[model samples]
Target: MSATSFAIETRGVTRVFDSRKGFLFREVSRTEALKGVDLAVEQGAIFGLLGPNGAGKTTLTKILSTLLLPTGGRAFVLGHDVVTDAEWLRPRIGLVLGGERGLYNRISGRENLRYFADLYGLPTAERERRIEEILERVDLSSAADRRVEEYSRGMKQKLHLARGILHRPQVLFLDEPTIGLDPKSARETRKLVRSLVADGVTIFLTTHYMFEAEELCPQLAILSKGRIVARDTVARLRQLVGGDRTLEAEAYGFEDSEVSALRRLPGVSKIIEEEYGPRTRLTLRVRTDEIRPDDVRALLPDHPELEVKERRTSLEDVYLDLVEEEAH
Candidate 1:
């Protein structure tokens, strides 16, 4: 697709942070936060980015949102270059870096929204009206006049979101939007995200929640060790990890020779071993319908205590497989 068709795009985007340490602060230590990362997010779509802690998710989000510049390549938001056209992109884009730090603790939530609205250059005639609408949309109208320091974590998150979309941005960047929310609050936050999409907003979401990503994002990319390890729909990602069908077997232990035997079974593509207290669990990724849980059970007939189960491969499985591979 063309540049204008995508709300966010990156080419060979890289970021390296150099810090001085030790005596006289002469020692230079380098950390590569993003390495040759290339990505494209379609307009009006919710694109989820999944990664572990310190995996460059925040670094890339900062770059795309114009909060920080890349060290090596280019990034664009809504067809505008992040580095060269940052001023133009800022108003068209909204960001909720989700936390307690952004809001003013001394003032009321309504006052916080008013402050941000002024910064976004909202028309004075419509500023109060817009703030009220946003407060209602995020279900925070009743608490709008309350002090921010007294707000719950979830309430603060909603206010952060309220401030983000108050300017009616075309693209929104949400970094761990539901990180510390209670279950009910997280669900409500997700519902609000859907409503924003319905209003023609393209969202770039970076989250560690697998269920959230699966539920909200039709397309997702996994970033590991500062690189795009995989990018696709969850269904396609399952195939990449191995297959949808997964068989798990547990026993006290399995001989190395027995594991090799399981690997030779028809449709078995990958085997992961894990230890649970006294028992050892072997998870097999199977690609064919011909292989049944009983089929796997027959191989471990020697272990009378062996237990076998079958289930579908989930997004968490795909994420672990890809991220683990990158770690090696």
Candidate 2:
């Protein structure tokens, strides 16, 4: 894609940390967080970086948001180079890192946002107006005056998000945004994200939650073993396994022993076991991506009491495919 079409771009970007000092409390050796990587995210799109822990998602987000520099290669946000034009790029992007130290604990949430607003140099009148708007958007209006130190983890996360958006940036980077939130709070955050995207803001999200990415982002890239294994819309990625493959099952007395048998079956790629309201359910990814009920049924004969159900391919399939490829 042309440079202008990309809200964020990176080419062969790499970052390494040297810890040769030997850590009794010190250091040890150089750790490579990101290997050669290339990416281009379109403007106004929620582009997800799907991966498990330590898979370079945060490193990529840090480089794009100007928190960390690449050890080699190039990275840019909104046409501005990360290293040389971080200042120019900074205001155009908002970052909501799912961690501590993003806000001032001594002050109220409103006070915290106002401080950041001033840092961005918003005028007196506009800063207050924007702060009020963001507080409402993040559902922190009721808690706006409470000291951040007293806020719950979810509240802190919301404040971090609010501070990032107060400047009304063109691109927003959210790294594990729902990391520590409760179910209700996480749902609220998802709603807030949808509202922001509807307002024309581009979001770059790094998350391990397959369902979250599946629900929120149409386009995504999976990072595994320090490289991007795949990049595509959720529907397109699901097509990798084909349309004829689905987990067809008959449920009666499903047991833990059934998982192993199911995995050994032809066309079954992965299996996830869960209990729902006292009923045991197994989620499986078929080797083929198509909807072939008979083949799936043919693979299971012992469980006549089993129920026939077809589970659709999701972001988890894409993630598992990447992980599986790495193992081979």
Candidate 3:
């Protein structure tokens, strides 16, 4: 689907945290949480907003969910302008803000869903059907009557999640839905999301885990320091950040002196590395236009004993490159 028809679309959407003074008893400060961020999520696609903490994911989500207004730019959710049509837009979207109290501790899971369903104006029969479907889908059927206060963190997260999507919103904004869950629970949650997407539900995900982005989102935007530095599919993004033929490999017993020598080698324009004991794993942005493998081999005459091999680039590598490049 064209991005314009997508469930969520933002154009130069900026959120400036206006400076506010604290009470007379405290000091105050101001910070710009989001800086001219732009993004779009295709209808029915699982789109990811990947960034570290405070990179503006929550700020952006709040703006889109109508919980906060942007200081500048434009944003539309389900074809409704966030600022102008917030009242109408709020019902068509569901949002879960990582871990927060979105439910009543005294309420049972089923009661919670019914409460949300009624709040969303779902008809009685439709509400029953929707609640049943969602409870089963999120695997909460067996404990549907359990009080939320008695639930574990993972269980509570599931309830809040179920409640968010209970009304069958056109857009689901899940901010770290699997944040504190164990590895298995996280995977199961991701799997359920994928199933929902396959059933044509639109999902907007914000996550700190890069692999989660790679797994769930066919389209994604990488936010760095409150701005998008890379946006595309898993493969295209990897290629965008690191062109074809990026040389990456692990080697053992590499000395600090060898790092400098490798930087000077032919076909190597930039040295990307992380130390591993005596060796260093490095990614070299190959300069094939200027120097080929033959050229690199020619330079290796200076260090024939070194262990090195070329390999393809991964999304993790591409992500690091983009973020680090921006930091520089």
Candidate 4:
């Protein structure tokens, strides 16, 4: 693919860290944070990266945003090489890392943004104007003068986003932007993200919230153990894991023969067994309407307490199935 076609692209991008343990006799250990990750994101879109903890989600974000360099392979933002053309990429990209790290607690919200605006080398004449605009955009205008130390968790996160876009970056990297936010704040943050995309900024988001990714990103990649295990739209991902529908059967227990019968039923592609105290839950990935709760009940006649249900396959189901498969 042409480099100019994608807002962000990577080929075999890898990062490894080595650290020594012990005080006197130290032994060096290596951890591979990212391994041969390849990705492509279109401009003016929100691309979601979902992964478990320590799965290199943040590491990839840092590399794409030019904050950390990859140990091997290449990365590009807006067609500029992350390693060789970092200087050119920096001014056009924005990064809002997760948590409370990049802000000064002693300063006001507006002051925090002013500091970042200056660092971004925004046009001297338009610096204050841009800061105000960003604050207003992030809905922090009323709390502009409040010290960051006193700002709520949500407000601080908004300030981080304001600082990130102070220079009007074409591509924004949001690393778990709503990690610690309340439901209402998180909803507002999601709204803000949608607006940013509407304004023509490409967003690279790493989020643990399955619903958030499903809601905001039209395209998604699941990263596990530093590798891209799956990349596709949510609907397609559902099919990859199983199908569009999920059938769940719960009872105290099931005979081996009963499970085999369910597996033999038409449209049943996969069945996952789980034990909960004295009861067991069997989850079936059904691809067709041929299998119903009554059909499952007919197969397991011995269980008097059997309860069967059916629902659409959710993104969480897809994520867990992929990540767990990678783990083994």
Which scores higher on TM-score, 3 or 4? Answer: 4
Residue range 1-328, candidate 2, lDDT tens digits: 2244578888999889886674476756778888899989888889999987888999899988999989998987887788888888888889999666678898899988888898898899898888988898889999999889999999999999998889999999999999878989999999988888998999999988899999999899999867888888888787664332456464654655556766776666666565667556666767654435655455566766666677666567667866777757
Error of 3 at 164 (Å): 1.6
Per-prediction TM-score, please? 0.97, 0.83, 0.85, 0.97
Per residue, candidate 3 scores C-alpha lDDT tens digits across 1-328 of 1226768888887777756566786655667777888888878999998877778898898999999999888898887788889989778889888574778889798998888898889998788988999989889999999888888888888887898888877888999899999888798899888887877889999988878888888898888777888899988875676454566545554455656776876656577778877766666776455644444444445555445556555667767888777677
TM-score: which is higher, 2 or 3?
3
Q: Which tens-of-lDDT digit does each residue in 260-319 have in candidate 1?
A: 999999889999999999999999998889999888788888899999999999899999
The collision pairs in model 4 are none
Full-model lDDT, candidate 1: 0.94
Off by over 4 Å in 2: 1-4, 23-28, 242-244, 248-309
What's the distance in Å from true for residue 138, model 3?
Answer: 0.7
Find the candidate with the highest lDDT and give its number: 1
Q: Give the range where candidate 2 is weakest over 10 consecutive residues by summed lDDT.
A: 241-250
* Lowest lDDT 10-residue stretch of candidate 1: 1-10
The superposed Cα distance between candidate 4 and the true structure at residue 266, in angstroms, equals: 1.0
Per-residue alpha-carbon lDDT of candidate 4 for residues 1-328, written as tens digits (9 for 90 to 100): 2355789999999999999999999999999999999999999999999999999999999999888999998998998888888888888999999577778999898877777788889888999888878888889989999889998888889988888889999999999999999999899999999998999999999999999999999999999999999999999999999899999999998888899999999889899999999999999999988888999988988888899999999999999999999999
